[model samples]
Target: MSKIDSSLFMSPVKQIVIGNIRKDTTIEDLKDCFSQLIKKHDVSFRIAVDKKGKQKGFAAVSIPITLVNDFLNYNGRNMKGHRITVVLSEDFKISKSTRWQQEETGVFKTPSPNQYNSLRSMPFLYKLFDAGVYLTHPKFSKNALNVIERAQSCGVKKMVVLGANVHQCEQALGLCRLFSGSLFCTAGLGPKHAPFWTDEAETQLTQIASSGHCVAIGECGLDLSTDELSSSQSQQLYAFEKQIQLSIKLKKPLVVIEKQAHIETLSLLQKYKDQLVDVVVSFVPENKAQIVKYVQEGFYIYIHGNVFLPQNSCIKKWLTDSDEETNVPFDRLLLGSAAPYHSVFRCTDIDWYPRQFTDDTQHKSFDIMLKHCKDNYSEPCSLPSMLVMMCCMVGDRFTPRSLAEKLTQNAVTFFHLDKSVGEEASVKVTGEKFCNKTPASHHRRWSFFVVTALVVVAAVVLLGVVCVKYSVLDKVGALYNLL
Candidate 1:
C-alpha cells in the first residue's frame, strides 16, 4: 500500500472554516456555490449563528477529505459579495468539535454493569472514552473485570486495551468480548519484548490481529533507554519493523511507544510514512522538542496521567508559535493511561475539575470522592477522573470545555469509537446496541467467547476468594468511591 502523503493529510477532518462571510448567506446559497465541487449528500453547510439569531459572519462546510483541496482552491473566491477566506478546520484548535455525539444512532448500551452503572460523571457534560489504556498490565489484568467495572462506574464509555505480545493480545480480545460496547484493543510487541519476537509469535500476532476486534496495531517502537536494549537494538528494530508491516497489511493505525530512541522511531515511521495509516506517539516522556517533532510529522500524541503537558506554557506556546503558513496544530493529541492513577503527583493548584462542568449535588459528590481517595491508600486515576484533572491542568482561563471535548474527540476519531452516552446507559452514535460490532456480534464470536467465559468466571471466583482472604475488597470499595 502506498503511504498517503503527509502533505495530503495536513487536515484530518473534512470540514473547513469560511471566514468573512455575508450575513445574508443561507445554507442553500453556500451549498449551491460548492455543489459542483463535492457530491456527497452528507456534505454539510452551516452558517454560525449567535444567541440573538444573527449570523456570526462565518460559515462551515464539512465534506469528504479527498475533496479538501478542491474546496481549498475556493479560498479568496468571491461569494455573497465578499472575498471568503477558506481554511481547513484542522488549522484551528477548538473548531474540531463534531456533532457525532449528538447523532441518534441508538445511543447503544443494553442494561448491565457495562452501563454507566455507578458514576459521578452522569452529571458532567463530557463522558470519558479513554482511547489508550494498558489493560493487560498486572495492575489491571489481575482483577481485570473488577477494575474495568470501576472505570465504567466512573462513566468511561470506551477503553482501548493495549497488548504488547500475542498472549496479551489474546487476553485483550477476551476483555473486549467481556465488555463488548465499552472496550476495543491494539495488538503489537513493545520494544522491551523485542527479544521475544519469534517467527511463530509473528504468525500468532498476525492471526490474532485478524480477529476484527482490534482497532489499531502497536505500542511497538524503538526504546534504547536501557543498556539491555543497547545490545539488542537490532532485535528491537526487527520487531518494530515487522509490526509496522503488520499495521500496513492490516490497514490499522499505529500506537508507537518511544523511549530515548526518539529519532530512531521517527526515522522508521518516516521511512514507511506513506504505507502507514495515522501514527500515535505514546508512553514517551520527554520535552516539548520531542512532541514538536511528532506533531510536525502529523502524528497524534497520547497523553497519560504520569505526564503534565498543559503547564510550563506548553498549550499557550503551541498556539502562538504556530501560524497558517506553517501550522503545528496542538489538535494532534490523544489520552490514555497504563495504570489507573498510580505515581501521578496531585497538583494542589489544580481543582478537581472546572467548576462549570458540575452542579451543586455533583460538586458535593466530587468533594466527598476527593476526601475518600485521600483517606484511602488506593489511587483515584480512573479515566474519567484523569480527564477532569486534565481539564484543570489546561484550564488557565481558556476554553476548558472545548479542550476536554477535543481530547475526547481525538480518541473517538483515532479508534473510531462511538461518541455518546445515555441516561444511566452508554451507547455510541450509530444507534447500534453495542459500540463495536465484532464483540457483540455472536455470529462471529460465539465459539471464541464460550471457551473464554468459563476461564473468566473462574478467575473472578478466585479473585473474590483472594480479596476476602486478604481483606482487599475493603480497599476495592475505595476504587469506585468516586460516587
Candidate 2:
C-alpha cells in the first residue's frame, strides 16, 4: 500500500489482509476472531470466506491510515497463537476480490519465553500489560460483545472502544453493563477522513455520558492529514470546544485526538482551561520545547511503541532532566500500546515494531525519579507520593488506584455520570509497591563492597607509580649533590 503521507492533507485507506486461515474456519468464526482486533481502531473493511467455505486462517482488513500508523507503532507484532503478518494489499492484482483477497499472509509464529525475555532486555521497553484491543464500527453489537469476551479471556481489564456513532455507543454501554466493573469506553468521533460527529451525535454522547458508562469525552479532536473529509481549523476548533464544554458541563474528563493541529488545539484548550480535565497527547511531538510546554501545562505523555522513534529521543531526555528538578512530576507518565490499528503501517513484510526503549533505560528512568523523590519528599513519602508527584507534574492531577478508578472518577466528576451507576462503578486500583529499604542499608551491604574493591585496586596502582618516581628522583638528586 502507498504510504499515506500524514504531512499531506490526503486520507488514504490502508488495508490489512489476513490470509492463510485453517481452510475449515467458518466466516462467523473468522469474523469472531478478527472482530476483537479491529474494535479499538478506526478501520473500514468487510469479511468474506473463500470458495472452499473453509477458514483460510487469514483476513484482509483495511483501516484508516492514521490507525495503520498507530498499529504498526504499537501492536503490530503478535496476535492470538500466531505472529500475525501485515502486508500491503492495495497494489496486488487479485482475480476475485470478494472483500477477501488471496494475498500472501505470513505464517503464524509465537516467540519463546527466552526470546520474549531477550527482547525485553534489549533496552528500556518493559511489558506493562498484555493489552487486548477492540476496533469496531459503532453499529456492530455482536462484534462489540465478542471483543469484550476476548478481552476478558486475555486478562485485559481496561479497554478503549473507538467511534462515536450511536450504535457503537450503545454497544459500548451494553458491554459496560454486562461486564459491570470490568469495561470502560472512550467516546471518540474519529478522524477527518471518516465522518464527523453531528449535533445528534453530541446528544447521544451526552446521553451516554449521563449513563455513567462513558468515562472520557473523546477520540474526538482534529486530524489535518486526510483530504477525503477535510476539516478546517474553525471546524476542528468548534468540535473540540463543543466536546470540552460538554465534558465541563457533564463533569467528565476529555480525551483529545490531535494530528498536526497542536498549536490550534493548545490555543483552544488554554482558552477553556478550566473545562478541560485530563489530556492524552497521542503522537509525540518533534519539537522539544513544545513537549516541555505541554508537560509544564500538565498533560500525560502517551508513548506508543513506534520503531521509527528512539527510546532516548529528545523527549525522553527532557523527561529525564525534568525529573531531577521538580519541574514536572513523574506520576503523570503513562504508557499505552496503540495496538491492532498499527498492523498496517509496515515497510517491508514486518508489521508492529517491538516496544521502544531498553530495559536499562526504563529502569533508569524510574530509578532517577525514585531517588529524586526520596531526597526531596518527607519520610512519609510512599509510592502514592511518587505517583501523585508524577501525575500532577506530568499528567492531570488525578491519580486513582487503577485505570478503572481513574475512569470512574473522570466519569462521575466530569461527565455527570448517573449517580447510582457512578457510585457502583467506583473502584480502587492497587498502589505500587513501596521500597522501605534505606540507602544506608544498601550502602553497607553493596556500596561498601564495591568501594573496598575500587580502593584496593587504586592503592596498588598508586604505590607502583610512586616507587618508580622515587627511584628516578633519588638518582638525579645524588648527581646534583656531587656536582
Top candidate by lDDT? 1
lDDT tens string, model 1, 1-483? Answer: 122222312122245777787887777777777877865556656566544456667766655445666777788889878998877654433221222111223132222211222222333444556777766665543345445555554445567888887777777775664454567777889888899999998888887677656788887998888898878899999999999999999888898988788878889999999998789987444555766777878898776655543443443344345345435454677767555443233434235354645455345435444543432122223444555565554545334446556766677677654432211233333212223333333553777787799889999999989999998977778876955
Task: Estimate the TM-score for candidate 1.
Answer: 0.56
User: Which candidate gets the maximum TM-score versus the true structure?
Assistant: 1
In model 1, which runs have C-alpha deviations exceeding 4 angstroms?
1-121, 283-285, 309-330, 341-381, 393-400, 418-483
Candidate 1 achieves a global lDDT of: 0.62
TM-score on alpha carbons, each prediction: 0.56, 0.45
